[model samples]
Each structure stands twice: as structure tokens, then as C-alpha cells.
Target: MSGRFQAAAPKAPSTLEKITKSPLFTVGLNTAYFVAGIAFIQSPLMEMLVPQL
Candidate 1:
């Protein structure tokens, strides 16, 4: 039992860890995805509605 507990102890994270570990990274990623989705929605609609000039 004590051996299992020792084995399960948490290890420290190494350097070069991902910036996405932070809340700011998550927000930035979500914002980028939202903007991309809006652009995707608009592009096809604009092309279809505006045919030529």
C-alpha cells in the first residue's frame, strides 16, 4: 500500500511545457476559432450572393 502511494506521487512538469496550459492561451485559441468560423460562414454566402462584380 505504501509502495503504491509512493508510485502515485505527482511529478513536476518539465520545461518547454505548452503555453496552452494557461487560460489566456485557451481564450486566444477559442477566439481564433470563432473568427475563423465567422469567416467561413461569410465567404460562401458572399460568393453565392454576389456572383460577378
Candidate 2:
């Protein structure tokens, strides 16, 4: 009888997890990353910081 117990329900996602899963949040995060990458690639700081491979 003890082995017949049902499995527990999954825990709910946290607020941060919910926010990050939203479409708008995903787009905004991707846009920010893209812009930062472009800025870093265009700036001279990239040359100073990274060695040519």
C-alpha cells in the first residue's frame, strides 16, 4: 500500500524564471547581447584586450 502513493506535483517556477521565459524578455535580452557584441567588435578596446588568433 505504501508503494501505491502518487508522485508529488512539480514545483512552480520562480518569478525570475517566469520573466526570463517570456517572449518579450527573450527578445530584449538577445537585442542587448547583439548590440553589446557589435559595440565591442567595432571598438578599439577589442584589439587592445584580445590577441589575434
List ranges where model 2 is wrong by over 4 Å.
47-53
Q: How accurate is candidate 1 locally (lDDT)?
A: 0.78
Residues 1-53 of candidate 2: C-alpha lDDT, one tens digit per residue? 77787989999999999998899998999999999999999999988999778
lDDT of 1 by residue, 1-46 (tens): 4555445777776653556587888899899999998897789776
- Model 1 deviation from the true structure expressed as Cα RMSD, one decimal place: 5.1
Error of 2 at 12 (Å): 3.0
Q: lDDT (CA) for every model shown?
A: 0.78, 0.94
> Cα deviation in Å at residue 39, candidate 2?
0.7
